[model samples]
Target: MAQLIRTPKQLGVVIRNAHARSGLTQQALADLVGTGQKTVSRIENGHDGTRMDTLFAIIAALDMDLQLGPRSKGGKDISEIF
Candidate 1:
């Protein structure tokens, strides 16, 4: 099955969970990325309009990879094969 990201909020939830699983607090992540705790909180709460640099920093801090590709037509998507 394909995992679909419906909204920025949903993405935020995933980021938050991943961060927790990696044993890093929001403040610690913010410090690592040279951002403030409030910014991290906003991101965690699904606030869209975050800067690309901020997003990249968050992804790096979480030790996660960001992938972009076309959506699936019906059931399985080409992205799943990769």
Candidate 2:
């Protein structure tokens, strides 16, 4: 499922939800991410200081893909205009 994330907090919610869906505890996810549980907690809570590498690792751990595309405007995909 592609989620449109516009803010760090929104991203955090997505990650937290994905983590729950994967049935992994925070500590377990932390272990998989090679980070501390506290770090995972901070991430889940939308800490904006997270490093890109760590964020990517967490996304990978949850089997989630990060994608970049043209931003939709007025709830319409820009690609649709062409």
Candidate 3:
């Protein structure tokens, strides 16, 4: 499946879902990413104020990849969904 997440909130949703799909608890993923469970919870809840390194670590821990393309064609591209 493919999800085009534009905002941090949507990215959080995708991470949460991916974590769920991986059958790992927040703490487990946190361990894999060398972070705390609370931090993972914060990320999943759409509080995206964390550092970019942490974000990338979370994404990598979940076996996910990021793809960036040219900006959307319209004023607001809601096509960015998880």
lDDT (CA) for every model shown? 0.82, 0.89, 0.85
Error of 3 at 44 (Å): 0.7
Instruction: Estimate, for each residue in 32-66, the C-alpha lDDT of model 1 and write its tens digit.
Output: 99999988888888998899899899988888888
Candidate ranking under TM-score, highest first, comes to 2, 3, 1
Model 3 lDDT per residue over 1-82, tens place: 6786777788889999999999999999999888899999998988968888888998998888988877655656456332
Report the backbone clash tally of model 2: 0
Best by lDDT: 2
Residue 72, candidate 3: C-alpha displacement in angstroms: 1.4
| Candidate 2 C-alpha lDDT tens digits along 1-82 | 8987877788899999999999999999999989999988998888889989999999999998999998666647654343
Candidate 2 residue runs with Cα over 4 Å from true position: 75-82
Over the full model, what C-alpha lDDT does candidate 3 score relative to the true structure?
0.85
lDDT of 1: 0.82
* Alpha-carbon TM-score of each model against the true structure: 0.80, 0.86, 0.84
